[model samples]
Target: MGDTNIVGGIVKILETPEHKTFSANISVTKFRVQFPQFRNTSVVHLTFWGNLARYVADFYKINDYILIEGYISLRTKRISSKVISKSKKIEITVFKVYPLLLS
Candidate 1:
């Protein structure tokens, strides 16, 4: 079993989902979702492959609260320019998303 189940409001939609085709004609859609914490908020980059990608892109909108169940992983990237820099990122690989409606 994995160690991640997150429930939060969608504070911002970083980018609209876009479809990309890779080797073997494998297709994927990627987007970002922000979850506000008590004092600080965390952003999660998400990728949905194939049908789920299309469904989420069409069905979900900004500011919609959602419950996400998935696994968490850390991503690191190097930024190079005048000075070399390293950036660390946290992302959730979403298995399921449940829309939350508040009364």
Candidate 2:
């Protein structure tokens, strides 16, 4: 097994018809874990893979609290802008996710 970077935060699962091929886009809102010098709320995007992918997608729901443990992956996707040109962005890929109790 490889060493994975863990990021924990609130779950924000996004589902779109186009993403039916693999799995729904999973995201974490207000991700506070970051570098020592950086203090900001960030969003983390996670892509489930293989058999475990379905489990994570099915079990987790929007607004659920979760702790994700996985390697940090950087992805660049093109986005359309109204007044600006094309843009590329980065995201995180989660391999493991666990639900946390509110209490």
TM-score of 1: 0.64
User: What are the models' TM-scores?
Assistant: 0.64, 0.52
- How many residue pairs collide in each prediction? 0, 0
For model 1, what is the error of residue 81's alpha carbon versus the real structure, in angstroms, after optimal superposition?
12
Output the number of the TM-score-best candidate: 1
The whole-model lDDT of each prediction reads: 0.63, 0.48
Residues 1-103, model 1: lDDT tens digits: 8665553343345556666877876667767777655334567777666666667777766566566666667777545643335676766666676676422
Per-prediction CA RMSD (Å): 4.6, 7.3
Candidate number of the best lDDT? 1
**In candidate 2, what are the lDDT values of residues 1-103, reduced to their tens digit?**
9775555454544332012332445432222222222343444556656545656555655455566666665545544634333543335556666766322
Worst 10 residues of 2 by lDDT: 28-37
Worst 10 residues of 1 by lDDT: 4-13
